[model samples]
Target: MRMIFIGPPGSGKGTQAQLLSQRLGLLHFATGDILRDAVAKDTPEGQRAKPFMTGGQLVPDIIVNDIVNARLRSKNRPVKFIMDGYPRTLAQANSFDAVLKEQGLDLDAVVFLNVGDEEIVRRNGARWTCINPECKATYNTLTRPPLTPGRCDLCQHLLYQREDDDPATIRRRLQYFHEQAAGILDHYARQGRLIEVPGRGDIEAIYASIVKALGK
Candidate 1:
């Protein structure tokens, strides 16, 4: 059940990864969550990543690759897992392949959730996040609105849209994603491990499609 879920921002790849991991009892290896955990613990890698994260810049591939490779070599390394957001670039994918080879692991599939740019902008435009750093719960006005408008359901913190969620920023982000994704997707497709799934429907329906594509 080792797989990777790759998609553009606002494609619901994180949500789908969580669901699929739970359903298959596989570890959900989400890079963002892992980096957040590192920052919370104030680990060495976190120290190096914090500046870039706070400045809204992408962390260098060397740092990201180091963290991922170390996890793969950990004593408690997962035997089965779903990678949600690692290998974001072709370079990262190449680095990941080396680590997987070293760990005697092989990816079964690389699922690409295909969503239109217009749809992504609409979805992300409606997204809001809790101001409370500890409870940065996210809500989408159209998909999963908060119980109280402009407030977080768990902590009651005021919700605000992230700057990156603005339509113009989202389009820029999408452009960058497509540029990087073309190479990564083609890399997997060449290996006969790529699974393309439509990402513009009900969450469950999209999940079902992925499952069927995986034949699981």
Candidate 2:
């Protein structure tokens, strides 16, 4: 299934995307990860995206849409894929639809991970990630912890808090999510293609909710 995930920054959209892609055999396409990798590599797209990211604004739709099209056009790429953290605007949604139309494909549905701001704040503010490239273990200060504080149990690598995961940054991201996602969500809803999954409780429970909501 060609699916899209719509959620706030801290709503576990990435986590759920990774999991659901594994479970459903779909390619997991995360725009943030892709852009970050490009930035880490100092690619052309990253150079263009860096300033916008530093300002916490969405990167220009033209650049992002080009990257999305490039990935979708790759040979032997997965026929079905799940999108995470793209199409933040109605204009981007229209652009995405146009590209898919050219390719004779379309999104099956958009899954909105519906979680409250309080939970989003709590979950994101406490998150940390392993800085080591070889072992990117993720943990949270409150909910999930490593065997030792600030350390990854797998490779004993240091776990560092992402600046974006800080309380203030998370709040700003949440606000941006709501403002930018409103029109996109409503657009899909009006087309009878929006499926909401309550994003609370354990991973398995949330996974179950997503599965049921997707009717799979």
Candidate 3:
């Protein structure tokens, strides 16, 4: 059941990946979470990644590849897992292929969550998050609105839209996503391991579509 979920930001690939991971009892290797954990722990790779992260810059491929390779080489490495938010570029994909080969593992599939740019913008525009450092709960006005407007349900703190969620920023991100996604998607497509699934609709429905696509 090893697979990777590839999609643009706000496309719900993360949500779908999490659901599928739970259903299949596979580890979900979300790159962002992994990087944050590393930075928190201040390991060698973490120390190298912190500056780029703090500067709001993308970490170099070498550092990211090193981190992922270390994990794959770990004694407790995940045998069956779902990758999310990783291999964002063609270079990373190539690096991952080498790592998988060294590990004697084969990727089963690469799920591509397809959603329109306008729809993504609309979806992300409605998102708001709790400002409380401890309670950074997120809400989407179009899907899961808070009980009280502009307030966090759990902490009663004011909710604000993330800078990245702004429509302009979203469009910029979508542009970057499309640019980088073409090569990665094409790479998987040529390998006959790419599976396309609609990313718009109810979360459960999307999850079901992904499950069916995987023949689960």
Candidate 4:
């Protein structure tokens, strides 16, 4: 099955995407990872995207669409794929449809994880990460605090909260998602290909709901 996962940051979309990809044998296409790889490889699209990235600006939709299409056109990529974080705007969603048509493929579903703003702030605020490069363990102050406060359990490195994970940043991100995602959500809903999954409770439970939604 070809699918896309969409939600605000801290909504567990990435975690669910990773889990679902493994369980269903689907290629996981995460946009951030793809963009970073493209930039690192200095591919044509990457070269085009680098200036904007370096300037701390969003990469233009055309460049992002080109990279995504190129990946979809790859011969070695899996037939079934799960898209995470691509098509962040309505224009990108339309472009994605055209790309899929050219590639003789169709998206089966778009899963929208419905998480509220307060939950987003609370969840993201508690996140802390290990400083060690090789042992990048993460702990949540609320849900999974490390055995030793302010230290990584595995590496004993100092655990620091990312600046972007602060409550204010999370609220801003959630607002941005609300502004950008409405049209994209409506597009999928009109196509009868949108699935709403609850973004609460444990990770396993949320994953189970998604599985059930997909009839897996």
| C-alpha lDDT values of all predictions | 0.91, 0.85, 0.94, 0.91
Candidate 1 lDDT over residue span 34-140, tens digit each:
88788889989888899999898999998899889988999999989999888999999999999999999999999999999999999889989999999999999
Model 1, total clashes = 0
Off by over 4 Å in 3: 127-162
Evaluate residue 54 in candidate 4 and report its C-alpha lDDT on the 0 to 100 scale. 87
Which 10-residue window of candidate 3 scores lowest in summed lDDT? 12-21
Cα lDDT tens digits for candidate 3, 1-216: 789899888898887888888889999999999999999999999999999999999999999999999999999999999999889999999999999999999999999999999999998899999999999999999889999999999999999989989899999989999999999999999999999998867999998898889998
Query: Runs in model 4 with CA error above 4 Å?
Result: 128-141, 144-162
* Per-residue C-alpha lDDT of model 2 across residues 81-179, encoded as one tens digit per residue: 899888879988988888888888867999999999989888877788999998788998897889899889898989987888788888887887888
Clashes of 2: 0
Give the worst 10-residue stretch by lDDT in candidate 1.
Answer: 31-40
TM, every model: 0.81, 0.75, 0.85, 0.85
Quick one: best lDDT, which candidate? 3
lDDT of 4 by residue, 1-216 (tens): 999899888898999999999999998999888998999999999999999898989998999999998988888755799999989999899999999988889889999999989988888889999989898799999989999999999989999878888787788888889999999999999999999998989999999999999888
